[model samples]
Target: MNTIKRNRKNRLSKLAVVALCTAMLAACGSNTTATTSTDSTAAATNTSQTTAASVQTASLDLSNSKVEYDEDDAYSDWNASEATTIKLNGTTATVEGTGAETKDGSVSITAAGTYVVSGKLDDGQIVVNVADEGVVRLILNGAEIHYSTSSPIYVEEAGKLILSLPEGTNNVVSDGTAYELADASTDEPNAAIFSKDDMTINGTGKLTVEGNYNNGIASKDKLKITGGTFEIHAADDAVMGRDLVAVKDGLFVIDAKGHGIKTTNDTEGEEGLIALEGGTYSIESGEDALHSTGGLLVSGGDLHIAAGDDAIHSEIALLISGGMVDITQSNEGLEAGSITIAGGEVHVVSSDDGVNAASGSSDTDGAAGEMPQEGAAPADMPPADMPPADMPQDGTAPADMGQGGGPRGGGMPGGEGSSNNLLTITGGYLSVDAQGDGLDANGGIAMSGGTVVVNGPTMNGNGSLDYDSTFEMTGGVLIAAGSSGMVQAVSDSSTQAGILMTYPQTQQAGTLIHLEDEAGNAIVTFAPSKDYQAVYISSPDMKKDTAYSLYSGGTSNGTETNGLYDGGNYSGGTKVVSFTAASTITWVNESGVTEASSGFGGRGRGGDRQVESTQS
Candidate 1:
């Protein structure tokens, strides 16, 4: 029953249903519907507070975690009458279960059993200290648990822990701002819901966790959630799983001073992985919203994230096959050693590189670009006097990252050893509005199918599309608009036809740019989000030696999706130029077909931002 959510055939957002069902089968051995979207407008913040970290060194496999779905989901649906009731009465609790006993301000469960908890605990704790290898199930039936100086629900040891939320129940758990741990040297159980063993949270009820101390939920081992509604506010990470964090379905509203959801098993093995297969998430975090030390796979869900740092980050592999993602605020929207997008509808608004593929080891990864100290807030980026593009980010500089800029090889000479850092997009629709480089890769990039629209950097230090190695495009439409400086065109080896046009001056924002074929057929119409002096367009309709007319300030009355217009009537636009696309790349200006590298690219971030072009 280990089904993968590789249903990329659902090209639209509605196709997420099919992927969600497959994810449920893989996670819970059941089929379920996707979570509905909420009307909370908290995900609209567009300005980022941090900058992106560059790359170091590491090679990681870009594989999915196909861990088998266990039978934990069944525990949530168990008979309520069979569950032993643990009724809480203010400071003390009366347990009707044989394995539990109440002490001073604490309730200890010593054996594996099904327990129902309700009522209120103002300043007490529930500690499950089972020694034997037996799974313990706890059903929260409208329970309110608050603890001072310790975890509210602490699983010291267990074969497995199940936190089942019964339907129609609203469970609330909170922790104090500090912890008096049993071992101060290690600081164990530092979250509101801290488990030392594998844990699973299932059912449709709501769980509210306020972690004034460290984290909202933290598991030392694998943490899986099949179904639940979680509203978590945390001083540290909202959810942390040492081994793996797998979610089949959930509705989550997360606001964290640290990372929203992350895995931290950076030691060895396949730990530190996060598989977000299905969910509806609205996250606002000071650091990376979704981060993984190993690999991150997001196949099905609706994610609206506003992050101060990177929106989604993985030290190794980051794969998005099917989903809907809106990164409303981020420094670097997506960052990883390798980023592969097979299918999805993604929108990014960032202050730095929108999608960055770089090679970085675990030792070099940190929030806001600097290595973080133990419990300190992530250091912010450049001050008011500094420009974001001029910062000394040594690892991300294209010159040192092997971007040679030519068709002979993507990065290294002859394209050898250029795959270490890569950004691959096979199918999807990605729209990016960035203040820095739009799509950046430290090594190389390849695109076979998809539509990419980038309104890139207005600064002269960054480009709309920046790659260290080479970019191979076989099929897809790519439209990028940015400044004239630091511009890099596609390689001449690409099978698709593309053209780069530089205006005499910077064009204003919302100024429409249109392209029409000789048959008067509109190819593409876009309005850049920022002022741009360069426009690049690559389309399937662009045939070799075929003339196309370019227009400026046009009115497109068609359906618009992320600046690209389709089936629209374009009028009132002045004709700019008429040129034929080369077999690969054609760089044009007011004086007809000009050379691709006019000696303008070698001045900024990378001195070799040069590309060979063909005369149109």
Candidate 2:
């Protein structure tokens, strides 16, 4: 008796009955019914016809078409509590079922076939543990399913599985979080909802995978997110895969306390690859926001990340061919085996170096650029100060550093042998605001085009001449403080000036002083007269406690004379000078050489003035 009941249960669960009353009500009219006997026969025939029309064996939808259910359609029923087992062969088909079952759960299919599941009811997690190796399509028709004990749906050893939901379905809940499977057993580490060998999610439904204590969705092979909204908050990683996790398109929001998305592969050439073609991704993570042991390429997407350590760290190359990436981090913004941003909008705010590629001791690998020699600086062009010909910066010069003018790379701090990392900025709007060296490259910096901005102390020393790095600006606008400026630069117009001074405690009745530019361009070379001889001369480059003598001869305002002589006394005829040193100097309105005396109308003219006047 028990065996018979079990068989009956299985058959009923598979062969579902369509409630004909609902279908007839949908086709109801205001016409009066015929005689009772005829009306009853017509109703029965109508029910049979409706059931036959709805039931069918079809293929899956390979084109990936879909329809949405809004608030107005929320009352409409599109679910099945039971369905007959039908083997799917193609990539397109739709399956309908009644959503009236209480305890037996939904239909169970073990065949290898591709199917699209849709409805408008709330069941528990729809389980699909397939035996054959074929694509299994699971579409939830605006229904909420709660996985109390087992996972909502389980797909085992399937060649491919596609999980989708209605486009307009909203507020679907899974233990306060939507869409995830969890097994509390301590031994099974890789346990979560939707454990499939391989799968694809293409639709408009939003799924929240929140199992921070364990994995969100464990896949033995690969998982690609072509579309949909995935909000994952996990303790380990949001998207976990034993092989590869490719994000071609979707709205992925991962707030992982650990790594945002990770893929670990033990194979040789089949390392995990995370390539982003189009979508929106926002990740906040403790370690690396987006990391893979293999290669990570962001060809096109909008990625905003806030990471505790490094925003993007990968073992291999991280190529940013196209994308809009905004990262705010504490440690480094991007660290990989090699980092190349040929095209993109990359804005990084980091405490350390904005973009760093610290090479590890794995094996002999050819980097994108020449490896920076030991005891040298980073090998990369500093941020270009010159604005790109395509896109210019917002502000103007001095204030904005203008376009194409970025911090020049002098050399990395410490020594050359520290770390041999290379950075190449062939194109893009690169903005880096760092607390450490603005642009420190061990190898070299090459500037072709684009805009790079670096604002900080170049070198660590006095404010005047203590630049930390040496810069070479081959092209582009180069703006740097202290030593961050480009090197050996010769422009069409250049201006340099300094102050000069000398003291004269007493002169031998005649003395002179000359002030000349460093290239012997004498701008101010003057000799004080007898009455004004005992004054002082000042220079801008004078150091404290250093002694200097006044030298003057044969010329004053283009006049030649001898009494203007005497390279003599300390305080007699001239030289009482004082000056200050600073990083930047601005002369408000500088005029030609003008001399003024501290003494009021010869007040300090002592013995000579008195005696000479009386004798005359």
Candidate 3:
């Protein structure tokens, strides 16, 4: 049986393939662009409060933040006769070699190392004032800068700033929605490539940024992106790094209003992390598409987000061992305080809670790396209950209680900021679609393997497995469809094996729930995009007495991808029940192994609250 913290009650919430094939055969046999580094992380950020005793810590322990880099930052095939070239002429910039200077239309540089800038500066500004702590290295080959009033590549003083874009070259940087400030008491040079100190951007060319007066590559300390192919359009924040934003590979395409790659050192111990090891991101943000205040370590990468608010918030520690994420939208799709998924392939679409672990809830939910204050628009999120007009349409009663009898609208868990959250799925593959709470944790949850699938919340206060102090499945496979007033299952000390069916009505939306295995095989060939009255399933081929068989409006040709299925040939559906798994949870309906109720309010722990398992 499973016994990790079913009562501790706090509550809460990519394969970086073959080093991307040896960095694409070393950028096609050294034509340039091959820095390759992605491997080093150690995020555990220390959290406390998880009290019910047991906690061996299932994941998120990558290793002490590796941080390497420096062999002259690994160079990239240079030699325009070994140094300064500058050239760029439009509004004027013909430095023709030696440490640079072009005055008024701008071109500064002041000495240090490799330059090779190349072409056009229209309204001008390539400044990089290197003094005494010099370490500049610019190499934008086909460059193009265009300042309309301010920053068009200004780095005022550098101790480090390597900006190469080798391979087939194509650089461009623009800024101009109005700026004119070099130090308006502090907005100093808002972005369009405005670095103040540590920065890095390596080869394979094709960079494009158009930050209309705000940010698009701002760096005041540590920022890294080991290969290039960016395409940003920021009005505010699209690749910032006041202290750290490492990515060992790259191919981004962002559109930000603020935060789509951030790490503003929020000072307090100054950790400001975001260490994604490799890359292929595609963000669209109005706020948060990878925000970090201290730790957010995605081991490798291939992210795809579309956030209006929070799609990967990490105010402390969030860890995904490898990577291939895809959040189609979000209000919250992976918030963190301490979260850990040991491997890859995740997909979420949230309006709220599709993998949340509320600990300081991102400080106020969304202001992530700060600066967004003009029109605003991301606050809402508190509505869930309204569905109990006297609920109880079947599936064996007891879900709308609330006053003394307990059990009402959602699963309950006690008080105080909810333990330290802690959600752990040991391997990969998660898929969720939520309106709210589809694998939520205020304090405890730990699955031993992977494969989770949820399509939660059709009202009745949000559920499809909400946890507040206990949910521990031993191995893989979970399937949670939504709305049964507030259904929940899994916690007889889980040793694998679980089941909860519900349904007396609503079930339309791709319906099709299969399960088989009497002589057939297939356990849960899915289908559920929305409408559901309930259905939970845990598996390792659910045994005990064996004999399973649940079907329902099916017809599998098989192969399906996110709706599940794998190997065809099923038929019309409707078989409904034939259970036999004896215990560790199995409470069916549509007239089958149904029984247990009067629970789901607080202690579904040892009592199991709803288990029947004896129908065949």
Candidate 4:
């Protein structure tokens, strides 16, 4: 029998455990304190049936949810016969000039009707200051506005504002390095287009915004975009909304030094929210590509993001029902206090955790590599015969756990403290290539249905999957390959069979790992992005007491089998080795030694044990 044991001498004293428990309790009780906790009592009582039921009940239905905006509402109730037309050319304006006024190469509209704006205004501005309840619409037809010391278009006091770019027109708005405020007592508009009231931009034309000072487009209230083409380059946030940011359909190409799309409203009941229904977005950002303080809901879109921080972030909960998201580069791919993915196609290549569920708000300046404090028992600790320190005796997690925790103060992937924060994947197709933990949750992780493939971290300090509380996979196809030092399995509540095996020798990058049934029908196929010594495979396709074989170095020949895309499209490679699985969950070491016959349960915390390394 091949067994891995942890050294017992490394265990903490009982007093230390008790003290840690007390601290965790205090943190959980405090609303402002940031700490996570583990519910060992609940974990102990978790049966496979109950776990599946919990996942089913918590699944989200986002079919009817869509981003809503009123297109004709801007022109509603207004008489087009009484409309005003303004034409500007090189600081000269030609207009009816009734409810409109021009001064110092700037145009100001004070009435509630349609205004057709056209031509060029160099180093000038368009100010909209209507009545307290007026709605004004500006139709741009081949308009180009630029200002050296202020926003090109500034909405100072409008109830509602709409900027419409008609088809076949090309509109441009630009701002310079410094903004000159209309009054020192008033807030300065620091964007190329700044609106203080509810604003919407829609039409079928192309609009470009260049902001050398702050932002490209900023709205203090709700900002909605229905249909248009946008090219934005900004020194700060490209598109910002303080209250709500909603996008129904658009073609957006953004390059920004700060967040690409962001909302900063953190009010209790009205925190900022971002809802994206349909669009094609290509973003390169210095910070998070999509961020919201309140919550974010994505139903459908095609997003390709390269960000310095998290690609998509929400301070509260983030729900993605449908989308095609490819995060080519990010510190963390997706992060939220609680994350729910019902349906989507997501591909993440991250330097840190691929999908992280932690108890922290989005911080624009925070970088990766800051570990969270482990609030729960360490993996090196011995399994407790009694209820764990922070766990109550009732076998229920604390009520506050659902509300989530704060930051772990920096340590490792699984931070200390109790957390009810959750990572729920009801349905999705997720592929991750990570240099850190592939899937990490400070609290609990539940997956009822999904297809997950992880090419995990090469370093032993992290695992393919790390969670502080419990990981329950009632129904899913999960293939994770990485280092063996921190290898973990789904909790006892899983119904599907799993195999955790360590290769006898190092498997080079692009090596084909194939799992097949006794009759040589392919079950799963993978090609890890990095050198790997261990692999974990689980699926509903695996049957109990079924004999299966794991084969390495096989030729796939570009054929798709078993609904799985080939990890490596191999050709003409001889089989290097094979292992026969004899149990529901099999663990094999590097010496080709089988622990299945010996009834090897799972790895627990204790001390270091010697296992042969695949790396020379």
Query: What TM-score, over all chains together, does every model reach?
Result: 0.80, 0.50, 0.37, 0.77
What's the number of clashes in each of the models? Answer: 5, 86, 15, 16
| Candidate order by decreasing lDDT | 1, 3, 4, 2
Scored by lDDT, the top model is: 1
Predict model 1's lDDT versus the native. 0.70
* Model 2 Cα lDDT, one tens digit per residue, 210-286: 55345566566666666778787765667766555656667888888777877666343445555566789899988
Q: Write the per-residue lDDT of candidate 1 for residues 490-550, one digit (tens) a residue.
A: 6565678887777766788899998888799888889887888787898888877777788
Cα lDDT listed for each candidate:
0.70, 0.40, 0.69, 0.65
The positional error of residue 235 in candidate 4, measured at the CA in angstroms, is 0.6
Q: Which 10-residue window in model 4 sums to the lowest lDDT?
A: 1-10
Number of the top candidate by TM-score?
1
Q: What is the per-residue lDDT of model 4 for residues 347-434, given as tens digits with 9 covering 90 to 100?
A: 9988777887654321221333333232122353212122223323322112222100111212223233224356777677888887
Instruction: Name the better of 1 and 4 by lDDT.
Output: 1
For model 2, how many clashes? 86
Write one digit per residue (lDDT tens) for candidate 3, span 476-519: 88898977765677666667887778777678768889988788
* TM-score ranking of the models: 1, 4, 2, 3
For each candidate in turn, give its C-alpha RMSD to the true structure in angstroms: 11.2, 28.2, 19.1, 11.1
Kindly provide the TM-score of model 3 when superposed on the true structure, using C-alpha atoms.
Answer: 0.37
